[model samples]
Target chain A: MENRTIKMTTPLTKEKIKDLNIGDIIELSGVIYTARDAAHNRIKENYENNRKQPIELEYQIIFYVGPTPAKPGKVIGSAAPTTSARMDKYVEMMLKQGITGMIGKGERADYVAELCREYGACYFLSIGGASAMIANQIKDVEVVAYEDLGTESIKRLKVEDLRLIVGIDSKGRTFQEEQVKKYKISK
Target chain B: MTRIMSTEDLIPVIAKLCMDACYHLSDNVIGALKAAYEKEESPYGRDTLKLLLDNAELASKEEMPVCHDTGMAVVMMEIGEQVSWVGKPLEEAVNDGVRKGYTEGYLRKSVYLDPLNRVNSGDNTPCVLHTEIVTGDKVKITVLPKGGGSENMGTFTNLVPADGVEGVKEFVLKSVLAAGGKACPPIVVGVGIGGTMDKTTLIAKKALLRPIGNRNPNQYYKELEEELLEEINKFGIGPLGMGGRVTALDVHIEYYPCHITSLPVAVNLQCHSVRQATIEL
Candidate 1:
């Protein structure tokens, strides 16, 4: 597929991502929230139990990450996307809570794709293991909630030109499925 | 006569190894990634490979971790049979080293205190240490910081003797395909054949320590490794499973004799950021 690079800003809405397709590269800017397994579980628990959430989720982007602690003079440490599949169970919950975009690495489950289509949400993939390079793109970070979770704390991050790929579009088409079909050698 | 060694002496060495392994991409992994970039057919795959290369360079230069998942410390120690330890217990020293390394180095503390409790250990402590008594007089220490993503993709199975080589190949391929982008493709595959079930899994993990492009000394296993590498890449999972020419950098197979009725096999995968460091003391 001939992929096109698009620049996007956070506080994304349905209109912003409705046209995004698999394989399109995105250079995203503005603010994003970081969460991983621990934070996700807590978020789900809070929502189900009618507890107050630490951060407002509506119209925001969530990046699945657990960054290293920054050294003496850095905005953040090696910050990169962790696997998204582990967060599959929480996808529908977050989307229902009004998160317009999710950024992570790897393929998601079939139900996640369906939920994205239903909720007009998009799943973006950052380069897995490209932590140092990704870290350079983050302009600022602050632990917004769950600080006791350590690396898994939910952090508010202001990023500049963070690179990402449209892994699964709002329409449920996935780059992984398309690429595998196109390239898998039938032997 | 046995040589007396102090457990305290290992603390600094192990600490440094942990930091060094996280910060620097091993030479072999870097070389393979460069080669993968050169040959990758997909634009997305090539771009991802380039980013990884740049990430490695920046990580080493800036003394930062290559990935956010600093990983659980898997320390393999080959202790000389003739050596006697003094000071604190060996495991205690190792844990201390891990604690100092993760805290001082600013790497992520990824280990949990208990499997069910789900609380962070806070120090990345109580690392998984595997020690073997060897004939040599010098102790060899190797630390492999195993990321949860690739480690989660590992699989083991016991096939009947009749299933043979083809079954092992099929199992490995299936595991890799199932892992897809999750394990972070362009991975290093480690296969262990024969031995008992537990031994097979252990050898499978140990097989990952072998340098990329290095083959097993045995002719048959070497050939199997070559064939597996070729086939896995053909799956077109590519650099980050976006599709391309290289899915796996190399395949290393380690085997041992097993009971006549058993054909046990295990597969372990290492992501592109293959972080391992070895030292002899």
Candidate 2:
């Protein structure tokens, strides 16, 4: 199937996320927040305690990444999505607070898929290990918090033409589940 | 007297090769990606492979890493029995090489002090160095910058000898199915059949350093690799497991003899990134 191109700028709205289909290609742009294993641990800490969180979740999109440091002249070093499953434990909190979109690679838990459907959210995937290609899409990056965590620091980024696909849409149509349905039986 | 090799001379060579391997996608890997792109039936899979090709090109041209996860440096040092070196211990030399390469190359430092402590080592060091002494006058160093996403999918099983090749085929297929996109499709499958559990895994990893698409020198293992490759590609997990025709770039098997009572199988999946390099001096 030919993929449809999309332009997404955060804060992502429920309407925007709902419009995506599983496997639609996206040429995402605009501001996005970055966090990974350590950052998520911190977020869950605040979430369960009813403390003020790091970044606002309302209408925001979080990308699961821990980028390498930028070289002398580069805007950002190679930046790519980590495994999404690592953050599956925290998906409910983010979804409950209205995080409309997520970007990462790999499959997530079944509950995360159900949550996306219930919350009008979407899960997007990029080319795994194509960090140099992904880095070219970022215009700027800054560590907004958690600098002590080194590469795992929470950061903000401005990106342009970052390519991705909807791995799981709001309706709960997921790339992985569908792929298994198609191929596992045929062979 | 054994021939003398300076530690300083080998250090820089190892450093340069480590850095270069991370930045440069070797020709064989690039060739395989290109071939997969052309042969892939699904548009998404093709696009993914194309982006990887572009990533490799950009990395080499810009002298940046192909992936943000520059990877844990696994260095294999094969020193000739006739050769001796005056300098830091071999492990220290390997670590020194990783230290310079990760820092100077602007690569990500991923070594951790402890699994639970979760503290970054600051500079990527304490290389997983494998040393061997063979009959020669030279030293050969091979570096594999292994990524975590794919490394997490590696599995080893001790099947009784009765399970045999059919059992192995089942395990290989099932492992790829379970790994799906998590290990990254269009992956290089490295299989080590026989040996002890740990030895099987090491040889499985060593299998990855062989050029992609090359056959095992042994006729029996070569045929097994070919059959496994065919079975894996038929899974329809395409690139990134999104659905397509190609699931594996190649399946490589390396084997050693084991006791009559047991068969040990180790499967190591390397993502499409496929970073590796070798230098002989």
Candidate 3:
């Protein structure tokens, strides 16, 4: 089957989100927020106490990553998704706050799968160990919030043609479960 | 007479190994990934392998890290009994090496001073070092810069003798399956069997020291390892666990005799990066 590549931007609306499906290969180019465990905790803590959210996240895409610090004369170090499951505890909260797209590697918890269905959100995965190659796709990266968290800081990434696969779709379809079924080596 | 070994000598050699491991993916690993790439049916899976191979090439050619997570330097040192080191202690020397390598190389600083306080170590130091003394004058050091994603998915259990090979197989499968997409398959699955609990797990980790595609010498275990690899890859976890034909590159098992009552089994996973380098002094 020929996989078609499409371009999309951040803060995707619900109608625009529905056009995407599980296993769709995308070359996303736009602004996305990067955050991981520590940053996720701080976001949750702040939201619970009714503090203003760190950034305007409504309908935004959050990438689960903690990039290595950049070397001199480098735009950013290898930037790739970390494990998404580690950030599962905060997904429901973020979805409630209008984060519609998540990116990382690995299968989400069963509850996370359920929440994606309820919230009409999607998940994307980047290739692990392909960071050096993937690093070439980014146009710019800046620490947008929580700079003290080091690599875990939320950053605004301007990406061009950043290739990815839709691991989970807004309709609750998933690549790890459904897509892998066809290729299973029969016992 | 003892041959004097100094932290002065150990630090530079170990530090060099750390940088080399980050810059280059061993040949065996590259070979295995290429082989898997050739046979993978999913275009997505194949593309992922291609990108990783590209990353390996770019990192090697440019002297950049293969991935951002240059990892915690898990250093294993073998000190010959005849060699006595002066200056800092062995652990401190290894940490010094890791610190210099990560800082000087401009790699990511990943260590935290305390779990509760969460202070970054600034320099990636205090590497996990293991030492064994044997009967020679030379020192051997191995650095496996272990990343967090894959390390988070390892499993260990003390299986009963009755549980047998079948039990071990099931455990290894479940561990890899649960690790799907997270450990970055086609991973090198390392199995440790027998010995006391602690000893068994260390040997399991040590099994990762072998290059990808190398099998245990024991015919029985080698056959078991092959069978396990064949089956796990069948689960369609593929590269990046997104779903595909190849999930594991190889399975390496190490075993030692244990007490009559216990059959301890430990499974440690190495991601596709398979970054490790060894130096002898």
Q: What are the clash counts of all predictions, listed in order?
A: 0, 0, 1
Error of 3 at A89 (Å): 1.2
DockQ for all models, in order?
0.79, 0.67, 0.72
lDDT tens string, model 2, A45-152? 888899988778788889898777789988988989988998999898888877888899988888988999999999999878889889989998988888888888
After superposition, candidate 3 runs with Cα above 4 Å error: none
Worst 10 residues of 1 chain A by lDDT: A177-186
**What value does the lDDT take at residue A66 in candidate 1?**
92
For model 1, the stretches where C-alpha displacement exceeds 4 angstroms are none
Higher-TM-score candidate among 1 and 2?
Answer: 1
Considering every candidate listed, which one attains the maximal TM-score?
Answer: 1
List model 3 lDDT by residue over B1-281, tens digit each.
68986787777777789889988988888888899989988988888888889889998987888988888889988888899778987788788888888877768888898989898888988888899998889888899999998888889998999999999999999999889888988888889999998998899899999877777898999899889988998898888876788898889999999999999999999898999999888
Fill in the DockQ of model 1: 0.79
List the candidate numbers ranked by DockQ, top first.
1, 3, 2
- Report, to 2 decimal places, the DockQ of model 3: 0.72
Candidate 3 overall lDDT versus native: 0.86
Cα lDDT tens digits, model 3, A28-135, are 888888989999999999899999988988889998877776778989887778888899899999999999889888888888878888898888888877787778
lDDT of 3 at B233: 80
Task: State the fnat of candidate 3 relative to the true structure.
Answer: 0.74
